[model samples]
Target: MGRHSRKGAEAIRPDAAAADPAGRPDVPRPSGGRRRRQGPVPPADGYTPFQDAPQVRGGHPEQREPGGGWGTGPQPRHETTGGQQRSYAYGSAPGAPDQDAAREQAVARQVSAQQAAQHAADGRTARQPAADPGAMPGPRREFVDAFDADPPTPVGTPEARSGAGAAGPPVEPEEAPDGEPAERREAKGGKGRTFTGIAAAAVTTVLAVVVAGQVAEDSAGRGAVARAAGVDRDGSEGASRSDARPTPEHAVTRAPEVKPLSYGEKMAQPYPIAADLKATGKFEAVPGLAKAPGKGQKYRYRIDVEKGLSLDAGLFAEAVQKTLNDDRSWAHNGAMTFERISSGSPDFVITLASPGTTGEWCAKSGLDTTIDNVSCDSAATDRVMINAYRWAQGSATFGPKLLLPYRQMLINHEVGHRLGYNHVSCRTPGALAPVMQQQTKSLDIDGIKCKPNPWVHPGS
Candidate 1:
């Protein structure tokens, strides 16, 4: 019984305070047997509202809503000091979820406007220019950085700067500043452009070869033209200096014993004489002289010995034959014969007489004579008339002991006369006396002897 009674009384102990719908207890009621109604309590932080409120973050309660141009909401407060209950009604439109979203949009707009103003003050546009599709962004950045940096000393003029471009931030492009991509540029035309040193040089070489060929052809054509016009490149003269007749002044006394040589080797070989007859214009070879004769009679050589002459007749004949044979020039053309007569049918003839009687005999017979000797002509035929009478015995010039060389010279001189070479005075200064000169008596010049026997071969 006692446990049941305590349960009823304690279980029925009046609610200490009535709870509101929020599950919080209501304020205490007054004591006097009459219950007192409680008013709204302050927030836990003990905040209060000012009596003459400065302002509300969002204007009026009716306007604080979406699209209502609202700003920040009012500060939180309580009704503690009997000031009118500061009801900060963060309002919402009929379809609005809350007032916070509208406030956020308004703040974003303010920030945008402030940025625009700042950009304008800095003398820059709010929007940047569009980027180019084909430009070098790296070069652009480099250009910008360089532009902002301190300027270098002026290179030229202010007009130069005006012509130059202005600088700014980099604007990247899809392509380079060279106008096109490397691949595109290469494909533009079928010109086949390529880069190479060796190949280019080869092309240049080919071109050079072509040009040289053209130049050579042109030069050849010009030469043909000149020839057709009768203009000679070797001057207007018909003959070379080598073709002219040479004089003893430039003759070389060569040894007839010089061994034969080939053409090229002979050109290199030295001559035995003191002078180079070829270089001095006195040397000549007459290959045509050995050619077949057009005359009806065969060419022949005759040596006529004067009767009672001191020269050995056989030696004379043999010497002449040997000299001619050794030279090969004169021997090729004719046959030689020895004779003794003042007149005969021979092609050539010689006469031997006493030195004392030589001039008398020629004078009596009506013949031409030299200072030391005489030469008689036989009206019958052309002849080599040698008078050995006036020569001193055993002398190089002439003697009873007839020198072979002297006789050869005489024969050559007379034969030359027969061949149309007249007696011309020797002109070589300090030279050997002419083979034609009367060395036995003539002393026209000092320190000079008779000309070499071969001097007439090249036309003395």
Candidate 2:
């Protein structure tokens, strides 16, 4: 048995040696009947070796000796572990460049360039010089020439180029020497001056038009006044006829003959009273005659009575001659004289006719006689047609107390028409009625009553 056990032990020894693959001679092996636990091989110096001693944990790789031992020394940095090297930057790890940081740097460079351009445009000096001398030139003649040769592209609008975008400060326009924006001042002053000129021109035109209208109105008014005053608009007297009369060759040499009579003798009553006169529609010339005793132009006249009337034509002729030769007659003041003509065409004819004939003659003469019985002087026929009814019976307006004066007024009034006199009224109440007044009708005019008058020249 002892021999068999020794041979078995030898065989186990050979198998153990074969299992030791490291071929370490000093290493101890397990001798129990079980197999050895699997483990790292020990060194021949009897020391255990550390595995992957220089390794990174939460931060940088731990410091270690060159022979893979723990030590307290600065460690060498690497871009990558057992791989391609990569560049590193601040706040970034190795193996790849910091794309986000590089992008930020590019944006910052663009912003700085924009700031420098803005400073130059605003006529200010930049604080910092350009980082790259070749990339950007300094402010010099050559740089200015180059810039001028290749001008920058123009912006679409002034607002966009002014840097007033959503993230930039607003730019302001330059001002003129007049303390206002150049463009704003020009717009305001130019428009204001133009408007002022237009307004002034309009006012001047209006004033001229008003003045012209007033001048025309004044001219028309003057013409109307001239016509109303019985004067020609051209400033000349409108005489009824030219003063041309055929006179005797001895008229200048001959002394006027006159027969003067007292007032009582002039007013003497004649035969065949007016009340006894018949109403006649026809007239006959008086036989009596007279000559003016004044040295001036002489006016010839004649008197006639209705043929069927009982009035004496000679007596009526005498009364007319006496009245015309009075100092208060139209011939007063040496302006003219009167002479009675018994025959031929006299300058004026004074006739006595009935009311019907008086109206007929008045109508034919274009005188208004329908309203009341009146005497009229026919300028065209040179006839003074005295109404016989008014002559013989007198007017109801003038009672018997004023019958004589009323007769004188009637003669003067009718004869005044032959002298180019127009109808007039008393200027005031109780005043003398003008000789041209129709006193045979009434002494009242336009709410004013006047006293009776008989002479052409009342003051005389």
Model 2: lDDT to the true structure:
0.57
Top-TM-score candidate index: 2
TM-score attained by model 1: 0.27
- Predicted candidate 2: what Cα RMSD to the true structure? 33.2
Backbone clash count for every predicted candidate, in the order shown = 13, 0
Model 2 misplacement above 4 A: 1-280, 368-370
Candidate 1 C-alpha lDDT tens digits along 1-460: 0001122322321233344555444344544342333344443456654423323336422222222121111221212222223222222111122223333333344345434434442343225465566522222333333323323323222112222213321111112234443223223211122112224544655777677789989999998877776668975734444556675765868768967554333222222311111122111111111222322234444454444333345445544444444332243334322222222244544333343344444555455464535444332444344454322232344443334444455555555555555555456754565645545444244544334433334341
> Residue 419's C-alpha lDDT in candidate 2?
75
TM-scores of the models, in the order given: 0.27, 0.40
lDDT of each: 0.38, 0.57
Count residue pairs with overlapping backbones in model 2. 0
